[model samples]
Target: MRGITLALDAMGGDFGPDVIVPAALQALRYYPQLELLLVGKPAAITNYLVKYNSISNDRISIVPTKYIINSEAKPSQAILSSQGTSMRVALELIKVGRAHACVSAGNTGALMGLAKLVLTPIAGIHRPALMVILPHQNNGKTVVLDIGANIKCNAMMLVQFAIIGEVIAKQIIGVVNVPRVALLNIGAENTKGFGNIHQAAKILSNISSINYIGYLEANELLTGKTDIIVCEGFVGNVTLKTMEGVIRFFLSLIKSSDDSVQHNFSMNTNIVCNFSYMNPDKYNGAYLVGLCGTVIKSHGAANQQAFTTAITQAVKAVERQISKKIASRLAECWITTE
Candidate 1:
C-alpha cells in the first residue's frame, strides 16, 4: 500500500493545473498510502503545487510533458500528433509500472485511444468500457458500464461487460455475495431488446457463477433491483446524460420557484440536497475497465471536489488490484482473447 502511486494528467482538464493541483493535494490528505505523479508543463504545475503546498512534498512528483490534446480533438488526431501530451505521458507511466494507475480529465476519446495504445486490453477483453457507480434508491450504488466507450456491442461483448461490472461491484462496492446482474433493455420481457441483448441474456442465465437476474429496463435503473447493468455505449451514454440533465433542470426549477412554493415544500429542499450528492461529480471517476492497466477518466469540467473523488477512485482501483482480479475472473470463465 505504501508503494501505491497514481499518475495524474494535471494539464488535461478544463481548469488545467489550477484545479488539479489543489485536488491532488487534497486527495493526498485523505489517502495516506497514495503518491502522485503530476504530468504537465513543469513550471505551470509547480506554481500551483507550491501555492497549495501539501504536508508531505515527498508524496508528489512532476513529469513534464510537451503538449495537450484539445478538448475537441478526435482520437485519430490525438494518436497522430499528441504523443507528448499530458494524458499520454500519464498513461505511459502506468504502462511502465512507474505508477499503479492513471487519472485524467482530458479529451475522453483521445484518452481512451491513447490508453489502449499504451496499455493494451486485458487478455479476454474486446474493448474497454467506461464504468461508474451511481447512487441507487436502496442506498447502494449500482455499477453501470459502456457509458461511452464502444458505441455498439455484440452478445459476447455484453457478457464481457458483465464480468467486468461484476468484478467491480464485488471488489470496489463490497457486495457481500453474488451481485445480481442484468442486461439493460427497452423492457424486461425476454423478446424486448435487440438480438444481441437477447443472446447476452441467455448466456448470463446459463453461467452458474453469475447471479443473472434477467433483463432490466431503464426505468428500474435507480431502484437498486440490480447490482450491475450492462448496455452498449450509445444507449448507456444517452441514459447517463439524460439523468444529468433532468437533475440539473429540476434543481434549477426548485431554486427559481417563488418563496411560497419554497416554504410549503421545504422537505423537498432536503431532497434537492440529496440530489446534489447524487450528482455525477461525486462519482466523477469512471474507469476504462478492461484495459491492462488501471485508467480512470474524470469529467473535463469537474471542480476541485469532483476531481478529488476521481483521485480517490483511482487509489481504490490500485489498492484492490482491479485489473488483476478481472483477468483472473475471465480465465475462470474460460474466455479467451483469441
Candidate 2:
C-alpha cells in the first residue's frame, strides 16, 4: 500500500506549534513511510524544525496560512470569515487529493461544518456525527458517537451512528462479529428515556448491524459489557464529562489512600486508579465521521502527548480507511431509503 499523506493544521491548539511539531516528528519516527503537510506560520515551524536539527526534508512540507480561528471565536462565524485558516486549507488539501486525510485541533463545529460543506457525507447518511473512543476498564475501549454534533437526532440517525461506530471499533481496536451496543439513558429500562432514545432503543434491538443490548445506565458503562453507546450530542457529551470527572476523583482518592495501594487493589480498582498509565490517546479529541477524508478536533488545551496521540490516531484512521469503510457499511443497511 502507498504511504498516506496527512494534512495537519498546526496553528490552532492551545500549545500551538510546540505541541504539533514534536508530535509530527514522533509520528514520523513511528511511521517512516508517512508524508506530512504542516499548515501554520513557516518561520515558527522552520525554527522548531531546525532546532530538532532536521532540515526541511522531502517527507515534511509546510503550507503556511495567515489566519487562525481562535477557540474563543464562534464556530460558524470563524468558518465564514476566513478561507485560508489552517483548518480550511487542510480540508482543501484533502478535497484536491494532495493528502489522504486531514486533522485540526480547532473549533469542533467549524471543522465539522467546513468538512461537511467541502467533503460531503456518504450517500445515504443525513448528517455527519462526532465519534470518540474512550479507554474502558474492561481491558478494551468503547466507541461513543454523536458527542455534541447534531444535538437533535431521530431513530434512524442513531441507528446509522451504530453502524458507523462498529466499523470504526473494528478497525481501531480489532473487534469483530459486532460489539455490544447500548443506548445512553438515565436507566436501563426502555421506558426510562424520552422520545428520541426510547424510540431509538426499539429500532436498535431489531437491527443486526450492532449487537444491541438495550439501554445502559451511565453507571453501567465500564462494566465491560457494552462496546458502543449511541446517543444524541448533549447526552453523550455530558456522559463523557461525567465519566472523566468520576475517574479523576477516584484516581486522586486512590493515590492519597496509601503508599502500598498498588498491591492492595484488585484488577478493576487498579485500572481506575492509574491515570498516568491510562492517559487517553488525547485529552479530548474528536474525529469527524461520515466524510470523504479523516479529520480530528483536538482539545484547545492539548499538550504534546495529546498531539502525538492525535497524529498517531490519524495514521491509524488512514491505514484503516475509516471514512471510506463507514460509508460502505452504511450503504449495506439501506439507510435513508425514501
Candidate 3:
C-alpha cells in the first residue's frame, strides 16, 4: 500500500480507452498510493485525465505505444512479430524495473505467450499454467488450475499442476497446511479415468506434493470438500464454460421473475447467485503461474469492474510474493539450473 505504480495497457480490452481510462480513475480511489503510467495513445489519454480536475497530470503519465492487440490476432504474431502493442510494452516495463506488475484485458493467448517469452519463468519451471478461483456450492471458493495453457499434459505435468494448485490455494485462498485436491474426471473412483489422469493420480499419490482427494466429476467442482481441482485445459475449458452457461441460465430466470414470484422468492435464495450473475470475462481472469513476474490475463471483452479487479489481483500477487513461494515449491521438486 506504499507507492506502487502499475503499468496498464490503455488501448487493450474491447471498449478501448473508454473502459481503461475510467477504470484507472476508479482504482485510484481504492488504492490511494497507486500511481499509473498509461501505456497507449497520448491525445486520448490526456483528454480523459483532463476531465478529473482533482487529480494532477504528472501522476497520470502516458507511455506512447501504437497498435492494439486484437482478440482475433494470433498470439504468436502479436508477441513475436510485432513489438508495438501495449501488452508487450507493459511486460517490458516489468523487465526493466520501470513497473512492478502488468495488467491487460487483451488477448488471453497473447498475454500468456508474452508472459513466458518476456518475463520468462523461474529457474526450475518448464511452462506456466493458468489458474482461477470459482465459487463452491458448499461455501467459499475452489481453485481451478490449467484453465487453457496446455491442452495436453503428461502425468508429471498434471502432478505439477496439483503442487502448483496447492501453493496458489495457500497464497490466494488462504488455505493453510494441505488443501484437499481432486482430479477432474468422468467419475470419482481412481478406476474411472485414463491417460494423464490415471497416471497423474499415481504420481500425485507418491510425490506427497498435495492433499490428493482422488478424482472428482464436473458436478463436484463446487461441492465444498475439494479445495483445488487439476486437469488438462481441454477438460478444464469445458467445465469452466459449463459453469458459465449455468450461471447465465439462472440470471435470465432472476431477471424474468414476475412480481408474484419475486414476492415468494428471496434475493438471497441461491448460494452463488450473485457470483453466478458475473460475466465469464469478469470472473474468468487467470494468473500465469511459474513466471518470474506477476502476469494476469482478463478476457478481451472484460468490463470496467473486471479490469479493476485484475489490478487488485496484481497487487496481491506482488505483495504476497507468490513468485517466491512458487519458486520454493518448484525447487523442492525440480533441480535448479541457476
TM-score of each: 0.94, 0.90, 0.90
lDDT of 3 by residue, 234-301 (tens): 77877887878887786666666734375646663553455553546555557888888887776667
Clash pairs for candidate 3? 137-222
User: Model-by-model lDDT, in order?
Assistant: 0.89, 0.79, 0.77
- lDDT per residue as tens, model 1, 157-177: 999999999999999999998
What TM-score does candidate 1 reach?
0.94
Q: Which residue pairs in model 2 clash with each other? A: none
Candidate 3 structure lDDT: 0.77
Write down the worst ten-residue block by lDDT for model 2: 275-284
Name the candidate, 2 or 3, with the larger lDDT value.
Answer: 2
For model 2 the TM-score comes to 0.90
Best by TM-score: 1
